[model samples]
Target: MVELSKARGSYVDPAPARVTVETWARDWLRSQSQLKPTTLVGYESALSKHIIPRWGRRSLSDIGYAEIQHWISDLSKNLAPQTVRNIYAVFSLVFSFAVRDGRLVRNPAEGIQLPRRIKAKRGYLTHAQVHRLADECGDSRTLVLFLAYTGLRWGEAAARRQRQSIPALRSLFMLSV
Candidate 1:
C-alpha cells in the first residue's frame, strides 16, 4: 500500500488492479488519434471479433501468459497466420497500455510463438510472354510493355505522366532493339 498525505490525515490505498481489459482497450483505442482510418477500423474489428469476446471482462491482473497462449492457439486453428498475428497484435497493444499505466508488471502477450506465414513464389515473364501480353492489350500495349521492361509497380506506373514516360519508353525501346 502507498500512503498519500491529505489535508486532514494520511490515506493508504493498494496498487491498482481493478481495470478490466475492455475498459483499458476502449481507452487505448480512443487515445490513438494519429492512426490511419483503415488501421483504426482494423484494430476495432480485431477487438470486437476476437479479443473482446473472450477476454474483455477479465481484470488486467488476472490475465497471464497461459491464458493468452491458449487464446492465440485457438485462433490459429481457424484463422490465417497473418490474421492471427493481427488479432494478437491488438491484444498485445492493449496489455502494453495496462503495463504502462502500472496496472500490470509485464505484458502477458509478449514472447508467444505464432504460426509462420508462407510466401508465394514470384513468376518472371519471358520476352515472348511480354510480347503476347502487349499484343493482347492492344491500345494499352505501351503500358504493359513499360511495366514488364521497367519493373515499375502498378501505383508508380499509374502516377507516371505521358510526357515523362514516353521519353523513357523510347530510350528503353532503342536499347532493346
Candidate 2:
C-alpha cells in the first residue's frame, strides 16, 4: 500500500522495482533534447564512465543518500575536484528528472557533499615579463602580447590561430564581448 503511493504514477506500470537506473536515465536523456552539445557530451560521459558503471544495473528505488556519498568519496580519491563535481551534477540531474517523471519521491543524489573546486590564483604578467616573452617568441611577438593583455581563459586543447589573430584583434580589440 505504501509503495503504491511512491510509484512513478505511470513509468512504473506493473513493476516499478524492475526499472533500473539505466532505464530511467535513458528515458531522462531522451527527454533532454534541449541540452547544448557540450552539456550533452558531459552528461553522456558521466553516465558511461562513472554513474552507469556503478549504478546502471541497480533499480531506481534502490538508491539512497548514503550509498551515493560513499561512491562520491571513492570518486574523489581518483579524479580532480571539479571533475567529480561535474559528474555529480550530471548524476543529480538524472535523479531530479526521475523524481519529476514520478519514478522516485525525491532525488537521492541531493545533499551529498561534493569536492570543492579551488580556483588557481590568477597571475598577472608584468610589462617587462611580456616584453621578454615576446622577444623570445620571435615572429609570434604580436600573438604573445595580445594574449597577455586579454583575460580570456584558454585550456591546452583550445584552438589558436597564428595568421588570423593579428587582423582579428585589430578589429575586435575595441569591443568587449
Candidate 3:
C-alpha cells in the first residue's frame, strides 16, 4: 500500500493539514510574481468574491469534490457560467499548489463537472454599415475604418501611439482618397 501510494504521488507530509484555504490561497497569490497585473487582479477578485468566502475557514484537506461541485452550482444561480469557472480555476490552483508543495496527498477538488460555457453568435457589419458608422464619428472616421479593415482588437488598437500609427494611417488615407 505504501509503494502504491508513492507510485501514485499520493504520499504527502501531514504538516499542511492544519493550513486553511484562505491562508494557502494568499500564499499562492504572493508566489505568482510573473503573472500579468490584470491576471493577478482577476485571481484576487475570484478569491475574494467567490472562493475564499465559502472555503476560507476550511482546511485544505477539508474541501471535498462534492462540496466544490455543489458550490459551483449555487454560484451559477447568480453568476455567469464563465465567472463560476474562473472562481473554480482559482480554487483549484490553490489546491494544486498544496499538492505540489506537499501540503496534501491529493486534491479533493478534482474531477468535478463544471457548467458548459455558452458561446454567443458573432456578427459582422457590412461595408456600408461600417461606412455609415465612420461618417457618424466624423473626426474619428479613420479610426473606425482602420478597425473595420484590420483584425486588431480594441485593446491592441487603443495602445497604439499616433507617431507609430501615422505611417499606416497615411497608406489607409491614400487608399480611401
In terms of TM-score, the best-performing candidate is 1
State in Å the error of residue 80, model 2: 0.8
The sequence of per-residue lDDT tens digits that candidate 2 reaches over residues 1-177 is 547654734334336545888887877787888989888888888999998989999987888899999999999999999999998988899888877765576788899999888898988777888878877987766556667777455552136664756678656533422
* Better candidate by lDDT, 1 or 3: 3
Q: Model 2 misses residue 113 by how many Å?
A: 0.8
Count of clashes in candidate 3:
0
Better of 2 and 3 by TM-score: 3
Model 2 off-target regions past 4 Å?
1-14, 138-143, 150-177
In model 1, where is the ten-residue run with the lowest total lDDT?
Answer: 5-14
Q: What clash count goes with each model?
A: 0, 1, 0
Better of 1 and 2 by TM-score: 1
- Give the alpha-carbon lDDT of every model: 0.83, 0.78, 0.86
lDDT per residue for candidate 3 within 11-70, as digits (tens), equals 665666779999999999999999999999999999997788888998888778888889
Question: How big is the positional error of residue 156 in model 1, measured in Å on the Cα after superposition?
Answer: 1.0
Q: Which tens-of-lDDT digit does each residue in 117-172 have in candidate 1?
A: 96869999889888888879977777788889778999999898989887777677
Please identify model 1 stretches exceeding 4 Å from their true place.
1-15, 174-177
TM-score of 1: 0.85
Worst 10 residues of 2 by lDDT: 8-17
Q: In candidate 1, residue 174 scores what lDDT?
A: 52
Q: What TM-score against the true fold does each predicted structure earn? A: 0.85, 0.73, 0.80
